[model samples]
Target: MAEKPAWLKPHGRPWTRGPGRVVFENPWIEVTEFDAVAPTGRPAHYGLVGFKNHAIAVLPIHDDGCVTLVGQNRLPFADYSWEIPEGGGPLAVDPLDGARRELAEETGLEADHWREVLQAQLSNSVTDELAFGFIATGLRQAAGGHQMDATEDLAIARPPFREALRAALDGHLKDVLTLAMLLRAYHMAREGALPAALARAMLG
Candidate 1:
């Protein structure tokens, strides 16, 4: 088991007074306090926000050693670019299901094998979202086809690992979460710790 860090402790009771947000809106995790004192004896809040959301990302490596990616227009970025298929939020069950669903919905591919690689809380001090990074292998093309939201226009692409990494580093691929997962996957593949197909994908 992983050891807990020294700063770990059960959350103290919320400091806010009375019930909030329940009467007028959907139920959400409320963060009463986001600022904290660090070892440097300085205060940092990292621009605290009230809630955390959960999301997932999929890196599909094919038999021919090419990583599956998507090029799409992002309203935030205001451009067409490359990124791994990812999304899921406010679900009723474990987020892994959402991860799998997003992969199939966005990329038209299914994996016979999937593993949870990491659980990351983005902007931990503020926001209330946990992003789960998953490693998927043994990919097979889907028959039912992709089911992306109409507003989300996506074109699938298969790029060799080096090329993909280069694109990521060069700003062609702009999603921070996708870049993080791919580089971590690359390191795992390099160490012979990832699926054989993933390794092959990186090489070819």
Candidate 2:
């Protein structure tokens, strides 16, 4: 059985949500305002952002340990963002399948091996955006080419895994999904969970 820290346990009282009304909604997200009771026994109003699809991220690591990344301009942040391949999976679909499609779409790559490395609740306080991150090894170019959205303008990069991880740690690559996936992949490499040769390539 897997072990967990003794100190690990849920803390504090749970918030009780009462009636809620949808404040805004679109194909991608819905905002709802709710009547709620805080953990501290206080009544409060809470606003929640609900996502209609699961977020999926893929770290496509080549045999040489180069991690494929995609760059695009983001309107919300008003900046160019470089990140691993990411996309939304329908709630009813397997997230790993979504990750594979995203990898092919954004980077025109596919993998012979896939491992689910991370699961995250993007923002528990405000959003219920669940994300799944994967490490895709044994990479190769997809013969079908990419299938990006018509509106997407993306730049691709093949950077050493260590360098990409460093940029994420140094705050240069600001995508949270990319950062989280890279950190998890690093841990996997160091902990011997990954193939030794591949791990060596990643770490060195």
lDDT winner: 2
> What TM-score quantifies how close candidate 1 is to the native fold?
0.75
Question: Worst 10-residue stretch by lDDT in candidate 2?
Answer: 1-10
Give per-residue CA lDDT, model 1, range 55-134, as digits (tens): 77877776666788888877865777688888865545677787778888998888988887767777665555778888
Q: lDDT score, residue 172, model 2?
A: 99
Candidate 1 ranges beyond 4 A from true positions: 4-53
Candidate 2 lDDT (Cα, whole model)?
0.94
Name model 2 segments beyond 4 Å from true.
Answer: 1-4
All-Cα superposition RMSD per candidate: 4.9, 1.2
Provide TM-scores for the models. 0.75, 0.96
lDDT of each: 0.73, 0.94
Candidate 1's C-alpha lDDT?
A: 0.73
